[model samples]
Target: MEQHSPSIRAQAVALMRQGVPNRVVAERLNIPRGTIGWWRSEDRKACGETYEQPTDCPRCTTRDFDESAYAYLLGLYLGDGHIISKRKQHHLSISCNAPQIGLVAAAEDAMRKVMPLPSVSQRHRSGCTEVKSYTRHWTCLFPQHAPGKKHERRIALEPWQQEIVDTHPWEFIRGLIHSDGCRITNWTTRMVAGERKRYEYPRYFFTNKSDDIRKLFTDTLDKVGVGWTTLARGSDPFNISVARKASVALMDTHVGPKH
Candidate 1:
């Protein structure tokens, strides 16, 4: 009944349980090999279980999940996704119009990368493709979800989420734009001196009923030096237009047109 520091003991136990060699674990933790061996022996005796190196260790085999990918997926889910929780099961679903299959595929890829799951499947509903997965971590990842619709309630990002978005603003913007925004060629005719000239230019427009979400989008854009203008009030879907030449160019470089 010798007392050991819980933190180091816990680390050692986890590593040993994962089939790490006692010598390797001791070396990695800077602890004596004899101590790790003793702990392992005690665990086997107390639990009446065998501890051996696993032929296929999940921790050693699985690829590392990218935080940036999760951040982007979070933005997409915030914009166009929904979560359905029934008891212990949670399903994360993001729907994109059939025409925007690329976005749907990207969402599926993001889901796979973020979660340690086999794959995400897609179902065609009406004109939209729903990319979805059942993961317990969905709620933990997206605490912004509430009982009502996103716009009906307040939507705010935690400081950690903000930090992720700040570091990868382009990915966040791409997810936001891909879900609820679009890029189009806007044409306008103007009189130059005595002549009338018509020109078509590319612009990015993001529309959402949620003011908080719109603010988040514009704020992120500002951080990336992308200028945007909000249309007059009383619009059906609150609109933010990025029509400035430089802003459009920047958005095009990052988001492009969703195929």
Candidate 2:
């Protein structure tokens, strides 16, 4: 590192003590930003000050953000995402199938769009990739996060969140499908005239163990004029099926299969 004169260091520290940001002080003094940051850290330590990283969280800062992205993220969270807000560990994690690299990129993009200040990373595990954003303020944006598993607890959206979902229902549905839903086709052979004809039925299915989440999904489908039905898997009514021709077409046009 290039050395700076004591006088220059003193001036930088003085400006920083007066609440001028490190970037401003660095530019004003023509010092490297990293050196300015070091000086500020040293000054704070000498004065017994604790440093707090700056954040651009939408809920905490009350700043306008990409609501379309946020609506999609909300669906992802409610479907299969989770937040860890422990004192030493804080982050939001969205798991994506390892083969679906597009969904991984989309998840990371949504996180950055909502809160760009925090760092984001992807961790590969088994057959999935976990996209994570490090920041405790995630709780502020995802107030629905709480103790216990999501399915074991009640999940409801805030009014503001509902408004965003109402505005961008398709994006929200896409997020949900990307996280916990899939597109499937069931085909059968039938006798037509004198020959066997193959008939294929394409449908979309969203499976989540949470009743409230399934309700939210169905409610959004209703808002978007898509018909859905609940199918019981043995005994658990945890599948939302969109098999109607019109509904399937609408889903294909908007959500489609996870890529």
Best-fitting candidate, measured by lDDT?
A: 2
Residue 23 of model 2 has an lDDT of 85
The TM-score, computed over Cα atoms with residue i paired to residue i, of candidate 1 is 0.73
lDDT for 157 (candidate 1): 91
- RMSD per candidate (Å) reads 11.6, 3.6
**Tens digit of per-residue lDDT, candidate 2, span 1-259:** 6888999999999998898988899899999999999888898899998988788988778789999999889888888799987785579999899999989999999999998888899999999999999988898889998899999999898998889999999999999998889999999999999999999999999999998999989999999999999999899999999999999999999988888
* List of clashing residue pairs for candidate 2: none
User: Which stretches of model 2 miss by more than 4 angstroms?
Assistant: 1-39, 47-50
- TM-score against native, each model: 0.73, 0.86
Worst 10 residues of 1 by lDDT: 52-61
State each candidate's clash count.
0, 0
Model 1 spans > 4 angstroms off: 1-64, 192-195, 233-237
The best candidate by TM-score is: 2
